[model samples]
Target: MASSVSAAAKASAAFAHKKELAAAAPAPTQHRAGSGRRSKPCRVRAVASPARAPRAPSSTGSVKTAMTMTEKILARASERAGLEPGENVWVDVDVLMTHDVCGPGTIGIFKKEFGGDAKVWDREKVVIIPDHYIFTSDERANRNVDILRDFCMEQNIKYFYDIKDLSNFKANPDYKGVCHVALAQEGHCRPGEVLLGTDSHTCNAGAFGQFATGIGNTDAGFVLGTGKALLKVPPTIRFVLDGEMPPYLLAKDLILQIIGEISVSGATYKSMEFVGSTVESLNMEERMTLCNMVIEAGGKNGVVPADETTFKYLEGKTSVDYEPVYSDAQARFFSDYRFDVSKLEPVVAKPHSPDNRALARECKDVKIDRVYIGSCTGGKTEDFLAAAKVFLASGKKVKVPTFLVPATQKVWMDLYSLPVPGSGGKTCSQIFEEAGCDTPASPSCGACLGGPRDTYARMNEPMVCVSTTNRNFPGRMGHKEGQIYLASPYTAAASALTGYVTDPRDFLM
Candidate 1:
């Protein structure tokens, strides 16, 4: 069985790398009409029928109202001429997603309210993925996935990513790990669309220039019965990030800095709109990382205006056409904050809170027992590449245990395939192996949410750990007494080498 799993992983790695290489080629040029603005929104040709396409902003009289991207998306989804902040509106849902942890409960609610015999409004638009607790011996955890499988089969859901074999993840080719990453990878995320999931990090999809947020089970049930949801338009808080990103700073640091500036509840019930040269410079995955933790800062959703980079990432990922929107030049903002990326340094959130920020260098004396590199926030292909770069540069074996969990199967494959730039020809997997780190485990949301007691890499003891995952609340990763320092992949890897909270610049420089 072990041999078969190994062989399957190897074969898939080779095949996945070929596709990655093809995708690495330069994207086609996207022409744009310059409006003399600092940021120009990319015009997307709508492929959906006229009814499905959002109505263009009205241009009837001399007076016109400016709308932010969040307001514009809500207006289109609700079929309104215009909308204002704090207004309750019934909006059309582009996609409804549920997963193992919440799927069973959401399913129960849907049946209770809509009747078991009633069919979903749109089977094609609902996405179900089982990721949270797939790799465990706990019966209840395993049963949760079974519930999702039966529900998906009964509903005839078109986009259900399921896994039946717990022993060998490679056996389940249909299964994609981690709900947030899987959603984007499977092409369910598109620009100018409304996406609601049972998970809070659903806001991660907003990075694609969409209105994506989390909804309760009851709200999800309502959307299940009818393809519409009653939502309130949130006021916009504009964050302008300028200057080139420093070598040591990743999107994780930028977001950590933002959260530290504004307390966890600072942006409560408001849309956080990220703009400016620095934001535009980020790739899709980096943008996703930036938006993923907005819920921690009490944000409604986070959006980056769609441009060439956004179009490039979605090229082969989706066949459905989407209309990307942007904030009007005169858009009203509840508040505006500006940041200079060049001035920022690598930072981490101390244990027990995502807002407890501190510089990496400040925590150098803090010893760590383990270093974790995975989660929707830091477990992408590029994230692993960054960690590998650090490890290769350090040229030292880890002094502490370093656990690796890829967010999805594709990432798992990439670890074994994608070569690290400037590392000769070494892949991330090879670098990790040489660094004395644990072999990258099967892709899943392992230990991020502190699943079943038997979960791999669970913090069973009261030890300090440097982790790339988000959230460091009490017992977030496992033991209540465990201390977790939330950090970027580079910092996590550097800490692993020294068994202390070391800054990546120590090695990178």
Candidate 2:
């Protein structure tokens, strides 16, 4: 597990010295690989389809008109660009992202389909980031990354090798982890843009108010070769949350409660919109965590109507000045869902599935062996503070093993500056260090996705483990034989203190 970070450091250093030169180089109008057939320039459009004519009223005298965010974007893209849902329309992509596990696959496909003999559709529209398998603990993983590095150089890909910081390798400056998080900080992802990546969590970009989604390796290959894809417009489901969240609750619980209601597949092939008072109150980090896991519930992507929270996080990070965009006042949705945080309690998802959720109180007596407090989902700053606060208030040490991992280098970089509730709020990481918690700041896929660190040593422990990761599938974290529960950061922390499946409400009360 540690080797992944080590390998990444080496890769980062090798690539660090070239950032200045790369940045200074003028943007190329032609493909670096010199593949594919060069074609005429194509015009870009926001909406690809036109609005449908109004339908005639039925005998009931009521007309129906509703559309989802995904539908609206695709419809608009199609109408304005003259593209049908299934038609392969070649266009410039706003952002292109690929990682190690899939980057080589995409690169290979690109070479085979369009290399040397043909001209690429667009070169400036691509980005390559190595994650998922940054560390090569095995011969195969090492070879995979080597192939990727070579291919990137050949293609002149603007690669973030080994999560390097252009020139400041020692300062680290938080450029080590998942592609989405890296892209967010590097200004590759922006609002009102379309992004496609080779990873499922590519939807993570929705946090930036962009139309981002994931596709399979084959799909990515096609897009890499032709800069075009066929898309099926998705329906949108709206969530209007009102009221305030108590100390024990936050965005993770809100999403869990939703999964409990909608089931894992309830929102299949649909886009989800998280809005209203509750959403507005959430900081950008919290919103990002929520939106990052929307796909786990089988939705195309999760989004929020851009507001102050969104603007504040993106102000200086984007290439262009921020211009907020929101759903039209008359924007249509397939169905509307509402949540009241004031009345909500801690929610947990049972193991082997994310949809098997129940209130924490429903299973208070369950025993726990391990507690994890990080992942791309709940490993952000807000999550750390919430968990540390509970531990500090109780002045208790976790009786069971607990693991805390920061999603990206940036997260760890800020962990020491977090303000505690009182005493003007001490850094949560300091408190965690004092509390005897194993809080290590490392890259993505650490424990939640079984990347190698802190794996389960025994099977059938029957211990109730609490985690903040997106899914709780069989053997997801460490072992299939061990029992696992998914909860908000507060809930996981509360359980950590008690060494039993405990309700976070107890600490708050």
Candidate 3:
């Protein structure tokens, strides 16, 4: 960890003060989650039932639209466990993921709740990722890692990534990132399976057609306690997208638009089924980024119907034989909306809130000081490519102090080998080096969270910047004074090149 910047550092002095930015962040959105007029309470069963069955299996002998990804997984897992949807029956979990901060707490809870040795029903099924506090800026966190280390050693858990990568303790070797990305990359997530984790982003695994969701510490404790947790079949909502996304817009833009439309908690307890040609056009990486942020929209989870893109990504990786699942055409959906992406513009979410979004062009004049290009949400190969495209095209050195951290070591290795497209003499590393940007690639959330050596400095300085990360909440990316605009990698790269908040579209123009 570099001692150059402290976690308390504020954004640049030229930007808004912390108090003012914080004020803008908490401004209530028009469509606050859970604030909508209550429609009559529809039974979960009623919502799950289809109006009609498939006429017959298709040529591929697969059901494209039968039940939603979430519905199918819950139904199958229930059948295997002799339960039914909406029965609230506790069933076996196909996978369990934990991070350091909550990992130790879950262990203690598991011992107390189950009243036995620290024994998980299946050691291999459990993945322990020590990302959050792995850097251990505090003495208590260090102690917690010791406890987690001892527990993993005792249980013979195979997936454990420690803090040596980037100072964040959650940086484990076998575990690359937030348990969600690690599971997806490592083939731990499979179609039609039930997965639970301690982190909210665990819903990210839903991209692979799994019924993955997050739970509270107590809930996770119960899972480890009994190797199972009860789930009520969630209703499904569908987003039918159309048209091609503009150059500046990507999966992140689509999700931000949805979050703005629905507010943070719109989907509350409903599963999101992403259908439409636009969704099909998205690669697995983009789909995963979309599903990864569903929790932010208050969806139980999000899903993209398994397609060739999904199968190709998972075919060789999954140890378990892979069978794709798709929502039925006549599948019951609680609500649905169609999005036209062709006309969509780059969107930005004002801080202290993710749902506070508007067209990026509307805020183009906003000045920026720092540009961040990493996070579980934005730290993928595709994301890096998008950012690199902007940087290469600009031919401008990074005007501000910029940083690029890989979401995981694996991602770093995958992207690091590739050369910067326009830099005839430079690789990605060389490009960042020339621009005076710090390029640190390693495991886990290195600088996003207010972990030591990666935190914000200068408490109330007003600074604006683009970030490729989830959540622009109050004090989320560091100082409350800094104005953080959540954007895609392209936007971040553009800002890094110009030293201000410049939309990628402008460069296209």
Judging by lDDT against the true structure, name the best candidate. 1
Could you arrange the candidates by lDDT from highest to lowest? 1, 3, 2
Candidate 3 shows a clash count of 29
- Checking candidate 1 for backbone clashes, the offending pairs are none
Who is ahead in lDDT, 1 or 3?
1
When 2 and 3 are scored with lDDT, the better candidate is 3
Worst 10 residues of 1 by lDDT: 1-10
Instruction: Rank candidates, TM-score, best first.
Output: 1, 3, 2
For model 2, residues 313-399, the per-residue Cα lDDT tens digits are 665665453332344344455556656678888889987788788888887888888888876688776788888888888777887
Model 1 reaches what TM-score against the true structure? Answer: 0.89
TM-score to native of every candidate shown? 0.89, 0.80, 0.82
lDDT by residue (tens digit), candidate 3, 29-148? 111112112232121221233333335545545443345557767766665312222446555788888887788889888888777575877788788877665543577767777777
lDDT of 3: 0.68
Tens-digit lDDT track for model 1 on 197-300?
A: 99999999999889999988889989999999999888887777888999888999989888876767767788888887888899999999999988888888
lDDT of each: 0.84, 0.65, 0.68
Per-candidate clashes come to 0, 21, 29
Off by over 4 Å in 3: 1-66, 80-87, 116-118, 163-175, 420-426, 453-462
